[model samples]
Target chain A: MRYTSFTSYDLILLAQGLGVSVALFLVTTLIGFLIGTIWAVMRFYRVPLLTPLITFLAELLKNSPVLVQLFLVFFGLPALLKINVTPVEAAVITLSGNTAAFIYVIAVAAIESIGRDQIESARVFGLSRWQILRHVVAPQAMAFAIGPLTGLLVNQLQVTSLISVIGVVDLTKIGNILNLRTLKPFIVWTVVGGLYYIAAKLIALGGARLERRLRAHTAWKGL
Target chain B: MILAPHVPFLLKGALLTAEACALALFGSLVIGLLVAALRTSSSPLLSRAAFIYVDLFRNIPFIVQLFFFFYGLPEIGIYIDAFTTGVLALSIAGGAFSSDVIRSGILAIDTGILEAAEVSGLSKPTIFRKIVMPIALRTSIRPLGSVFINLVLTSSILSTITLNELTGSAKIVASDTFRPFEVYAVLLIVYASLTYLISLAIGALHRRLNRDRMPDVA
Candidate 1:
């Protein structure tokens, strides 16, 4: 007899799926943030050959679909490099790289948003370039970048769902499994979508809170 | 190298992708305009309903929405083909995003224009048609272009539903020749170039439409 009835275990399965999704999202987001910030720094320093190359790579990543990028890493990389790539590994790599590309753009823009006069004043204070960046740019850029970064985070959270395609057992993959087993697409997918929606909203809320904190200094305080 | 044999097959897939995108683009624009209208309407209830629709659609991952339609619709006795399901899903999701763009466009309109139209005794529909839509759409052409380009990219996800769009056909060719790398890499470049060309065209269109406005941006 086909065991198609709804099991309480399914909730546990969903939680597990959500856990995997969030974990991967966090890990990849951290890696992407570091790599993206580094790329922005490279551009800031005007590293001749690497700067344009990084820009080009970011452009390609930004323009293409994440699904295509996933396929390239999951299927393409193993075949080309003769390496074993687990589904989770592929998801991490692809999502991180994709996230990095976007973060790089925001970082570059944030850095550029800083006026030249501020940097010149810091320079005249005899601060080195690195010191100037650390003292004069980092805080202001963080404030400027936080807003866009939140938007990107919300998007990247949704993007984490795509990892299901590469068999990462993310929320969508769990939804797929439940969908086929119970043949209840409406219930299964709705629950799955609801989970994602909540997660996205939470991220947005967190981002908004962070943005508020970052911008608190500039906020009006007049009586 | 082996891709030479599959070029014709991939082109066939590309054509299907184009067809689905075109249909979905039109569907999305219509839905987007309607939603934008509702969201901007004076009635708080209609505007709130539209807001909820946009928010719900925007927050959810699209794959979930696709599965919801693909499997849920059949259960409800709506037996549409995978292609129709894909297009419908794309339009619904794309509508949410496009509506946001159009709503922003509408909000950016000068209050003076609306007041002037009112003083000229223009009907609501007429005002929207002659004054609101033209100005809003003109200013928003660039953002709408990005939204449409996103539509094109998102259309690739339709492959998961057994619709043999570009990505779907490429998956077939990849397995057939055991050349996943070349197939997907080429697919990546094709998608990038496709969106790049789209943005370029959108840039030109934006300039053309907004020519009389800000010369700085144009």
Candidate 2:
């Protein structure tokens, strides 16, 4: 028998694939956030060499396609450095780096969105630079950033699908497998695309909730 | 030296990429303009339908959409070549994004101008073509250019469909020369510079177009 029909186990496989995709999305997002914020902090302090270098790297990353970056890490790096890289490891590294580059851009923009007068005012109150950044800038910048950050996260989620191309066996990869097995591209892709669409919507909703909370203090009240 | 021997091959691929992007750009502009018009129209039904199209296309991954079209079209007996399919896919996706940009450009138009056009007894199509489109497109030149540049970068994905674009050719060279690093690195830089040049050109075009009316923006 050719065994081409869909099995009940395929649902479990899809669930597993969704788990991998979401887990990778969360982990890479956390890593990207930390690294990106650190880069922003470095720039805030005006670190001599690192600031400019980070900016350049971020620009290079922003301009190029994520697929190229994934290929570089997955295939190029292993060959060049003589190190072994599994597909998942490569996906994590590439996705996180790409996410960090974008986050760095957004964070920098958010930070710059803070008025210089606020910092000067804090300084006049005898606060140190770090203290001013934390006490004065952080809160407002967070509020400023959440909207764009949500947009970026939704984008990055879609980007995670590309990892399938490099053999990560992600949700899209699972979809590919089932698609090949059943030879039903329409059904397979529709279900897969639907899953992705729902995930994106959830992320957008969460971001909106967060943005509302962050901006609650400034929202207008009835007279 | 690593890239020298492969320059001609890469250039051939670039020509195809350029051709595909040009066609797709033209296609996208038409779709984008129509969608923008629909979205901005007085009819709620058309606007809602247009909104759903934009949202669905924008939310879905381009590769998935490409695969859907690539695979599903044949199932429906709508056979087409990969090149045409790729162009169509790009135009559809690009239309979604460019429509949003153009829609904003349309929204940004001064109400006074529209009122004046209305008083001058211009028909809806004539008003759109004469007053609204020129102004919207002119103001939105820069963003639309970014959309086109994105179209160029996104063209790399067409390689997956067996279209011999720049990225596809680079893949062949990479495997043949056994230099994945050099090949991809050079490829990355080439794409970046190409987009950079396009942005520069867009900036010049924007300045030139807006020179007469909006000197500050120019």
Candidate 3:
């Protein structure tokens, strides 16, 4: 007896798969956010030798393929360093670093968008560097950064799909399993791609909302 | 220690990676130029068709598209090797992106300049050839560099279809060498450094190309 029909359980599998992808995405994004902010600050302060080094590191991470980064972490690092790296761990590290690199660039640009006069004024007002960053730079920079940040997040969402290759059992991997079992690329891939598409759209929508809120202070109040 | 012996094999893989990226870059540029022209054309139908192609390719995951072509192609009469398939897929995807850059480049051309050429009695083909393309290309050289960098990064996905480019080669070395972490770390650094150098060169080129056109900010 051949069982070629689509099973009802595949829905559950897809949901579970998407859960893994989203969970990993959120976790890494948070980690990446923090690390990327730090990298940006490194540049902002002109930390002597460290600034160029961070810039170089970010460039390297930004330019190279995530797949190579994944392999390096997942397959290469374990063998060379003689340490165990879970697939999820590898995915998190690689994706976070990659995300951070892009964010670092955006943050630096956002910070720079705040003209020197504004920074100098803040400096004159007896604001500490930390206070200036928090009270002066961060607010304005966030507004400046949000537009490009939305684009980056959208691209990063697509990038999360690559983690499936490292055996993270993410949505893409689930689709692979279902596709082979059901032998229906049309049904399987369409469903998988639809889920991804919806998720991407949702992120974009959320980003738009966040950007609006961030930019609210800068909205014109009319003369 | 284990991977020390695989240097020769890895070098061979690097060569394959270079070859694939080189071919794919040329293929993408040709495809990009044609699509860019279509996008900017006066014909609404052609422009709409080009827009749909770009949107479809950009929205779909590369792996899904790759699998569709890899599995779906055999169902049809077409049969191509993995290397060829990889290059073809890269070209299509890269073209979609490259076209966007080129289209903007085309749009950025001065209407005044075009008018001058037209008033000179230059044909459409000659105007596009001698006047528009050179200027658009010179201004866009930097954006095009990023697209190519993304293409290089995307090439790693080609490995899943059984094409052992640089990342593919490193995969074998990792398992055989019994140092997955170290091997991958090194590979990551190598790729990063390679692209850094490429962008540095692009920056230099952009500065040179736009040196005389300072006010325009090419």
Top-TM-score candidate index: 1
| Per-model TM values vs. the true structure | 0.98, 0.97, 0.91
What tens-digit string does per-residue lDDT give for candidate 1 at B15-128? Answer: 999999999999999999899999999999999999999999999998889999999998988899999999999999999999999999999999999999999999999988
Tens-place lDDT digits, model 2, residues A53-133: 999888888788788888888889988999999999999998898899999999999999999999998999999999988
Q: Relative to the unseen true structure, what is the C-alpha lDDT of residue B134 in candidate 1, on a scale of 0 to 100?
A: 84
DockQ-wise, the better of 1 and 2 is 1
> Which structure is stronger by DockQ: 1 or 3?
1
First chain TM-score for all predictions: 0.98, 0.98, 0.97
Estimate the TM-score for candidate 1. Answer: 0.98
Candidate 2 has a TM-score of 0.97
Error at A211, model 3, angstroms = 2.5
Worst 10 residues of 1 chain A by lDDT: A1-10
lDDT of 2: 0.92
- Model 3 error, position B2 (Å): 5.6
lDDT (10s digit) by residue, model 2, range B1-218:
77789999999999999999999999999999999999999999999999999988888888889988998889888999999999999999999999999999999999999999999999999999999999999999999999999899888889988998998898899888899998899888988889889999999999999998877768
Tens-digit per-residue lDDT, B81-197, candidate 3? 999888888999999999999999999998999899999999988987798788888889999999988888898898898888888888888777667777777787778777778
lDDT at A14, model 3: 97
Candidate 3, position A76, lDDT: 65
